[model samples]
Target: MSTNRRTFLTGLAAAGGFAIASPAVLGQAKPRVVVIGGGAGGATAARYIAKDSAGAISVALIEENEVYQTCFHSNLFIGGFKSYEEISHRYDALAKNHGITLARARATQIDRDKKEVVLSTGARLPYDRLVVSPGIDLKYDSVPGWSKDVEEAMPHGWKPGRQTQLIKQKLDAVPNGGTILMIAPPNPYRCPPGPYERASMFAHVLKASGKRDCKIFILDPKDSFSKQGVFQEGWEKHYGAMIEWLGPKVHDGIKSVDPKTNTVVTGFETYKDCAFVNVIPAQMAGEIARSAGLAPAGGYCTIDPASMKSVVDPNIFVLGDACIGGDMPKSAFSANSQAKVAAMVIRGELAGARTFPARYINTCWSLIETDDTVKVGGRYEAKDGKIAAAETFVSQPRESAELRKENQAENVGWYAAITADMFS
Candidate 1:
């Protein structure tokens, strides 16, 4: 084995040994794992543990929302191609079929010393192991002059459900030949390609509505974004003169917006009377993670790649957008991939078996236009206590009609499979 690989395996073995020994010293009962945030990662972990443990280990899930509206296909709703109901799912299947106790409550805090999760209702759920996938929480303050109360004026729509509908409503209410301003957040946010895809979908709506004069302006914090070249090409071909992008150097791309005045300030220039403003701000792990003392100073939870366990509190493991996994962008696909790895590690540790070196894979697909799509995929491996991309499977700038059609179809299929895997 390579030097780095050898070192990683050795460290994992040592950590596993320490975990096993510590239980004996601590005098804990049979292992019971509790998972928080029953979205992609938490749901997957709960189902896998419940099925794989064979009743030897207990598994429980906690979530605030009874229904989950996936963010993956939410852009379709914005584009008027699909309804919100199409992307929403319930937890009935998880509770009835999976044999996992679904606690419909928000986690208030995690007592690391006692290994217990405190709920918002003041109920405490004890666990031998805790898995958190609370996902991303919007940093509204990241953009000056914007607060939660001002959300009605400028919707971030980062989270799924009502916020998405509100943004779509705002778009639909805009006058014909109006301008839509989309502000993309900085790096290390949920779904790197989401903002661009959203802009494309909005443009599609504008074209279909016969608003030929309507334009979508993207104010981006980064110089370049995912599938930039392909998205630009699609915009030029499909919505010529209707789409414009300004990067950081372009006056830092709208430093602030005064909702009442209907003005967006970028350096010395001001854009007034924009119909809709979709401001995607910076993101961090959900408040639950921060309350649980799981997040690091940088506002994300640090975890050991081998087991996805929080370094400070070994009993707790965090995944999805909340985790700081090297080279893994926070996306539903990446969360699903990491969930499987986390499940295997939890299973092995609880079963007193050796934790195997594992690999994770993530593939993110973005629709530039109705028939044009772009994708990027990669594999990650644990190295020296952190995860690193081992390989990539990316789509080219331009694709054949057949390939584009295949991707579009596959995107739907993937969504179905993943959501089913989570709730069903």
Candidate 2:
């Protein structure tokens, strides 16, 4: 850690009075802030609060994993373009250097009336303000014949880590010129262009393996998808017949899957003998959010747009994929932007300043091929009691090779800087 960062953290601890003279003396009163789910949104919020609060807020971060592997570039790993280690990060820096109390445990429930969070281990954390950003959990039971037991046979690989590796291994072990099946969920899922990008990556691997006959079949519930025009053009120009996309109206898509037989059944037909399958089921807010009574009927948290505070409980703020941001796609970039705004709002509230309306920025990039990338960016403003897109900063199709390369490099730089800002 840098000397400047250490000095900043020390000053924050002194201001917040979080540093204890001894372990026994640590049980005194303090303005506690508990953050659930240490992913992009939660981690960024925690880092900012710990760094900028100047000891006025004591932040505790709860996450199940000690190390986090990003979902953003996991498709590249599946496509054989990158390794798992390339996208994984540890939280030691945040704990040891940033003065954050990192708890590696799942949050069990929230007692809103008591202003406390209960962990699975039975420890209760009292907080003046709480933040939830657990991301999404797959709704496996939504799709008939697909259950948690079938995960070993056909992985979703949506949340990153071992499931991702399992799918990649299956793809690698498949026979040359074999077929890979990808089941894409409906709208309002994480990463709008993710499934298509996964398909493109798989096609790249097949092309490199001398398996020109190999095919990637995308069974999508929606008739249209993000970056559709750019993806279609890239597919035709690069992979051509190697990639097949079946929309809901045409193929009826996949209603269910039989893991025992390795068969995917659509309303119109059934596919058999699939070498590998990635069934990305529908999603909802993480379990902790739902348990806390923060989630609404749509399985996402409802928050006031101005303060990012829970509608059911004012002391709690929800952001990122767990919260319903009007008309915003759930992406890491979007999460980071929301975190910054939420942090600012929370800080102002803590400092006893009047809260202002929130503004957000979103930029999503999808890598169609090794050298081909597509991007979309926009700014959002809260208007008429709902957040809406105010301006499109950059939403265009990829045309030139130079632009694609530049976008790819920019995407990498963004991943590095954002992650560093959060954990480092």
Candidate 3:
């Protein structure tokens, strides 16, 4: 973020007088704010509430994992540009410095009637306001003949952590001239450019390792993807004929996938044998969100655009990949941006703190090759009862190498800055 943007957000945080509807949460003795998932959205919301309220609000963050492996730049790590520890963030700082309670246990249920979150250990946490940001969950049955049990053989690496490491290890173990297949997810998934960037990283590894004979196949369910022209241009320029993308017109549909034999079956062709297969199935909001009836039939929670409050319940807010982020792609930066708005709004409702109109910004920078990156971003605001795009930009093809290098620098810088914004 630039100094101008930082100053603008700080000003918004400091000075505002608007008030929204609230439950009977006002004038409580240190009203509790409970945040779940502790990723970009949860952590930022928790920190901002504790900091801005100056201990007037008690914040509790519930995350099952002590260390969070960010999914934002895991592709870069797989491509050898980053170390594992570099993307991992710890919650010790959040607890010690922010005076927030950290709960390290799986949240099993959201008892809206009782106004409590039931943990896996059978403990209940009462809250005046709840922020559910559990991120995404893969629909195991979305892919034919694939299930959670098959993840060991065919890993998605979508949510990061061990799956990320497993995919990296598998990539390293592939023999020279071997073929790798990736089953791309459908639209409305997290990280719009992730799969293609990962494919570029795979090619980068092969080209660097003198394994140019290896081939990569991306069977995408969509006709086109984000930054299609630029990605295709870069692949043709750098990877030569090493990568091939088969769209729905060509693949027709996925018949089945046999993880036991490392095979993928498509309508046009059946890959009877493959060295490695990475399948990213369809996704939905996390288990707790769907189970709590907050998410509608579409498998994502609906939220008021201005405050990010759940449409069904004013006291509950949903953030990150779990909420229907109209006109916004589900990126870590977007989640972090939404978190701040939710924090400000929650404070306005609970502590009678000042509030301002919500504005969100997101920029997704994708690394294609060495010092070669591309990006797509925008600024958004609430309009017509929905969060709509106000301004947008994307990388263009035939750009100078120097400009691409500059974009890569931006990618690195933004990653460092946003990690601190979320976890520090």
What TM-score would each prediction reach against the true structure?
Answer: 0.94, 0.90, 0.95
- Residue pairs clashing, model 3: none
Point to the candidate with the largest TM-score: 3
lDDT winner between 2 and 3, please give it: 3
lDDT of each: 0.84, 0.80, 0.90
Alpha-carbon RMSD, candidate 2? 7.1
- Please give the TM-score that candidate 3 achieves against the real structure: 0.95
Candidate ranking under lDDT, highest first, comes to: 3, 1, 2
Give lDDT tens digits, candidate 2, residues 1-424. 9854664455455334422333232344456789998888899889888777767668899998988999988988888767889889999998777689988888898888988889888899888779999999899787788888998799888888899888788877777778788888887888888889888988887787887888788988888888888888888888888888898888865667888878889989888888888888999998889877888676888877655778888678898888888877788877887887677666655643233346788888878788677887788866655567888744355589888878888878887888897789
The C-alpha stretches of model 2 lying farther than 4 A from their native spots are: 1-29, 353-357, 393-398
- Prediction-by-prediction clash tally: 0, 1, 0
Model 3 Cα shift for residue 196 (angstroms): 0.4
